[model samples]
Target chain A: MVHVGANPGRSGHRLSAQAARIVFDTRQGLAELFGVSDSRQIVFTSNATAGLNIALHGMLGPRDHVVTTSMEHNSVMRPLRHLARERGVRITVVAADREGRVDPAAIREALEPKTRLVAINHGSNVVGCIQPIAQIKEAIGKVPLLVDAAQTAGSYPISIERDGIDLLAFSGHKSLLGPAGTGGLYVRPELDLPPLVRGGTGSRSESDQQPDFRPDKYESGTLNTCGIAGLGAGVRFILERGVETIHNHEMNLLDVFLERLRRIEGVVLYGPSSTEARLPTVSLNVEGKSPSQVGGLLDKRHDIMVRVGLHCAPDAHRTIGTFPDGTVRFSAGALNTTDEMEQAVAAVDEIARS
Target chain B: MSSGKHVVLAFDSIHDVIKAEKIIVRHGIWCDLIPTPRELSSDCGMSIECRTDDLPDLESLRENGALEWRDIHRPE
Candidate 1:
């Protein structure tokens, strides 16, 4: 299907004005999905990494303190590290539980008067544990909360306004089923943020100076229009399918995988065992087998796709006692089926036994 | 399809359209990348069409960042 929003700024002529309205409607739909008041609050980016960078660099400066969890993807961790190294920002990493879950009290204890931003990953990429963001926001009191929702956005229901999230970064490619390089940020209207990239926004093309706006300020150069359109299609697909149904489907798969893996001897699973407190992703290590070995075997022998290694969250792996070596990650999605999970379980059983 | 009269252009970056036109003319594909018209809703600002049969190779172009595809027909 032809994607929506593929010709955003350039669409003044090609499509009838009514077709263009679909783009606006898609943005509005996104706003409603995230529980934001205005669609203007949503700014599109090339990817979630860019959105995270924008949120980190735009809102932080020298001597500003930020609190984050150990389970963050590199999208959040790398930027904070850069800020600390170059801009003199202080960052405190709140430790997670043995199951890779971050406790709100731990985040509260890490906070200080200088803490300007409290950033956390909604769902861990390595262990699939879901952080208690509402509790963390409550503990933060007044600090602006920035959530990296790269793995959770379309897969789970989110309400940025209701949850007190000041900024949210999400990826369109993963759970959203959009094309890669499509992501966005939801910034609260009241926050004062510096522009990450400044250039022409098509609205005021004649003016050399950048427009002082939420999206135009952050979005520099031309956008990935086709990717955004695909993202819109993906989002609409998810909205129609229902986030709760997607969540249930993934959770059911997770339950089956966990139960099957737990029954096997010498197989170790990380993160919460219960489906209620986690995403559908599961990370596990088979005794006497490295993650790379298992991942290779699964792909080469079984034609199954799985991610292995640090999964870009070293601290999370460390929290779950899988650091350095990492674990094999099987991330279930709306497209995944019970048969696939069974096939994966059988593959794991074979690999573990051999 | 006209005999050797068509051209195909694939682009990863919109900026690559300039390069694609030069290469197409050099190889004699008789095609060029133009700013996407209103009828074609593609992500990038440019599209290429030399022949309808070139559509089968669209996935190859996608690997280079051509997120959308369109066919251009020159009015005889």
Candidate 2:
């Protein structure tokens, strides 16, 4: 923030150009991360919810049907809900198994003649089950697939072309290790979704209408350049470290945490039984204590930080049969070590006993 | 080499201009980023200033989908 603070794309000055370069590099970095050939297909947003909102609202119309899984967060749920009530859009939420796994064939069965979009989360923020995106895409045939990668973007290996993902929304804060308020959406080159909002794009000053372009079409206002710079650096670090290496490290941490938690009495774990099919996120509840109680104790006494309750995905909690009361969710990242996981497990054990 | 002749390539956005500039430099061609001339276009952003002789290379870049230019200006 100290230097290169000029508003990007607004002027021709060196500092402004520098700021624009920062934004460009971020787009390129995200493109590289997601295996997008053209970086222009990626557009910056305030968060993943903003990106999802754009992809959903821009593409879907009245009488259009959307098929989404039960493991989706409110980011996907709320927009679909609004479209259903306001725009007369139809929604069919395919139920996932108790472990939060959605069958690919079920997605095919759920398809309708009016189905315009199939929205699903790449990973569950609450239960951590990773979806089979390619299989789901194959099942849906020609319909467009929108994957919300808010929980899996940086942590998992995702290639838009290889995975057959038409639209992907991701969060920079969760697994990308970027600052808050930095996220993006990737629009497949073949797809044309209108902008959520339109204004000055620093280009086409002569035209009052919104410029029909890749990024400038979606990104209307001034971007969070400072946040994007940090996001670019974070993506660079991930690239250097290798996403596979980071994934293995996180899974190892999850394995150790899971083993330790299983040994503790009165603790019931949720999500996939194995670590191979899930992220490092884990949800559990003590036999008798409420999630809030255990979460509060973990914070106050043990100084261990973990999110508690619905996590904004009541449907996910409902899928795992932890709705209303919710679960104590623990999410580990690349920086977390096995030692820290052990400490967290010990804290959970104590909380379980209490 | 002092050839007074120059070709101006204006793009729809600064992103394309910067991308084209990088590609031109990578191809070992000479180019300068200057403010888009008002006569060429109303875009207040930047544009590419290159030698007229490098038009062939810019054409090849555009043909390969590597560059996108809205308009070209050549001195009479």
Candidate 3:
């Protein structure tokens, strides 16, 4: 940030060019991380919600039907609801199993002749169940698939091409290890979705109209070059260590944590039983204790913090029968050690017992 | 003034200009990212300046799909 604080692509000066280089490197780095062939296909956004908004609002029109699931966060739900109210768009929400697993056949059955897009949450933020994205692609033939990878971008293995994902929205802060306000959307090169915002891209200065291009089409105004620089370094760190290695490490921690929690008398766990089918996030509740109460105790007494309540996905909370009140989610990261997992589990056990 | 000694390549996007600059420099050719010359039509604000001696190399890079440019100009 100190090095490249200048506005990228705004001028032909050395500092501007340096800032542009940082943005370009970050773009290339993200493309590499997501297994995208063309880096230009991805455009920076403020966060995953913004990316999802672009994909949702830009592509869907009045009377267009979209197929989604109950496992989606408000990032997908709120936008679709707005589209339905404002543009008269139709939506079909496929229900996931109690474990937050969406069936591919259910998704295929939801598709209509006028279905314009199929949007799925790649991983449920509430339950941590990883959706069967590639299999869903085979089910819904030519309809474009938009995968919201907000919770799984760097934590899970995702290849846009190999998975047949038409669009991907990811958050850099969660698993990509970048700072907040850094995220992006990847549009398949063949799909020409219109820009959500347009003004100055530092290109086509002679023309008053917005330029028709890969990135500049979606990316308008000055970008968060400083955040992108950090994102680049974060993605670089992930690439150097390898995603599979990180995933395996987190899974190991999760295994230890879940095993200990399962042995507790009053604790009830949510999501898949196997580690392979989920991210490192675990949701649970203790008998006779509200989620917030447990969360507060864990914070003030044990010095261990966890997210409690609905987690912004009311439908997911409803699916798991934890609605109105929610579950206390213990999210494990790559840096979390097995010893830390044991300590956390011990803390939870103590809380449940009391 | 038409400077026959140097060639300026204009591109459609800053991405292409930066990419072409990297490929050109990596090929042992000297180039600088300059503002697009007034005489050339370009969609981007930046262009690359290189010696005329490297023109053949730039052409080869384009043929090999390493570089893409909208116009070539020699400004006086």
Candidate 4:
């Protein structure tokens, strides 16, 4: 609010020079986090959904073929589904295994000559399994890869160039620790996708036609300058602390939490075993109780916060064979203490015994 | 002698000039956000100025994609 208040343009009409600097800094910081050279490749959006939409809408058209995965959240899936129905875009969904793992070979096999893009997620929200994106890139030679990094951006390390990702979309609120309604998409410099919106950019004001450039090409109208300032702060915090350090800390805590919880009888843990490099998210069910019931018990009785239900990834739940009744999701953030893990594990164990 | 040979960094907008200042300063060089000299640039209202001695550091920052500078000048 202060950023917007200090700046004249709330909806992007007349922005004070200060807010623009923060926006650029925010993009540059994110680029550094992604291990990319140019921050100009980073474009802001309302959220990852909007970012994904910008990529899809800009890249996909009638009869354009796209290859995606079953483990995708509705953000990617729904957009593709709509494109298929409304725009005649053909889609091939690579099936995930019972463990919610997609075989890169399957994705490679699904690709056809007409395929315009290949979309996949870096991590699964439900199963918490990390995908080998680089291997998948190797499988699909030169097929532009669009990654949904919503679950993995801040919690893990991603290198756009190293990973061979063409376009990457990520949410700011989840792992970036920024305010909601803030996120961005990174498009490789050589690649140009159509703008999501075309409006005032304070550039080429002489002509009504929107300027075709990097940030101006994609970002039209006023942006969430305040949120972006906050997002820049969030990225700086990650940078100063180190992404790998935070990731390692979260994984270690998850290890301790899983070690304690999975051993309890009647506790049904979902997703990959502790052997895999996964997010700190753990989903489980108490044998005789509902997920919501167990979640409530953890919250009310143990003062633990967790997300329960489908987690906006129905296909992921179905892949794990939990359809209507979802698992209780316990996500350990960067700040979670070892004691909190123990208390959460003890809470689940007590609930399981009851 | 090199102090007179300064780099001129211009942008498309004042906000971008401000962004350039932040990026340059963060990289450890002191840059003055001055009014864009008409002779140096027709880009934005503001530009960044740094001593020519910092050229290598500026080059490294540019290589790292610190900011996309429009033009640079060295006056005799």
3 against 4, candidate with superior TM-score: 3
Which candidate has the highest lDDT of all?
A: 3
Docking class of predicted structure 4:
incorrect
Q: Which parts of model 1 are misplaced by more than 4 Å?
A: A1-7, A16-22, B1-76
Candidate 1's DockQ is 0.03
Clashing pairs in 3: B1-B76, B2-B76, B3-B75
Candidate 1 lDDT, A140-169, residue by residue in tens: 888999999999998888989888899999
User: Which whole-number lDDT from 0 to 100 does residue A119 have in model 1?
Assistant: 93
Question: Per-residue CA lDDT of candidate 2, range A3-115, in tens?
Answer: 99988778777788778778888888888889998898999999999999999998899989999989999999998999999999999999999999999999999999999
What is the full ranking by DockQ, best candidate first?
Answer: 3, 2, 4, 1
lDDT of each residue in A1-354, candidate 3, tens digit only: 696678777788888888878888899989989999888899999999999999999889989999999999999999999999999999999999999999999999999999999999999999899998999999998999999999999999999999889999999898899999999999998887888998999888888898888788888888988888889988999999999999999999988998889999999999998897789999999999999999999999989999999999999999999998999999988778998899999999898888
lDDT per residue (tens digit) for residues A197-293 in model 4? 8887655454667666677678777788889888888999999998899999998998998888868999888888873768998888888898899
Q: How big is the positional error of residue A246 in model 4, measured in Å on the Cα after superposition?
A: 1.1
Write model 2 residue lDDT over B1-76, tens digit each, in one string: 1244888888877677777777888889998877677767666487778998888988998899877788887766
**Residue-pair clashes, model 2:** 0
The candidate, 3 or 4, that scores higher on lDDT is 3
Clashing pairs in 2: none
Per-model chain A TM: 0.95, 0.99, 0.99, 0.95
